[model samples]
Target: MLEQTGLKVSSRYIAQIKKKCGLDVGENFNLPKSKNARQPQCTPEKKEA
Candidate 1:
């Protein structure tokens, strides 16, 4: 439908929309790159002795 209406979904267009909507402009802005990407204190839970 988007292609038929000429309102397509492209990387450039998406980036522009994101910018207009005050969203992140950089790639992987909201996504995690790794398991401990944002976790500075990652640790495993301890079991009872």
Candidate 2:
């Protein structure tokens, strides 16, 4: 909307301004963590009988 009025600003700069105003800024990274990965990354290709 501001751009329509001839005002140009970058997203980074907008975040900086919002932060200065004590407002929530930046993207939400609330990713759900996976269950415990107790299994080892490497495993035997074939289990010896």
In TM-score terms, which candidate is top?
2
Clashes of each: 0, 0
Residue-level lDDT of model 1, residues 1-49, one tens digit each, is 2655544345655565567569888865566768766523211221110
Candidate 1 lDDT score relative to the true structure: 0.49
Instruction: Quantify all predictions' global Cα lDDT against the true fold.
Output: 0.49, 0.47
Candidate 2, after superposition: displacement of residue 39 in Å? Answer: 42
**Candidate 2, superposed: residue stretches over 4 Å from native:** 1-4, 27-49
- Residue 43 displacement (Å), model 2: 57
Name the candidate that leads on lDDT.
1
Taking the tens digit of each residue's C-alpha lDDT, what string does model 2 give over 1-49?
2555444445545555566569998683753477663422211221110
Q: List pairs with backbone clashes in candidate 2.
A: none
Error of model 2, residue 48, in angstroms: 72
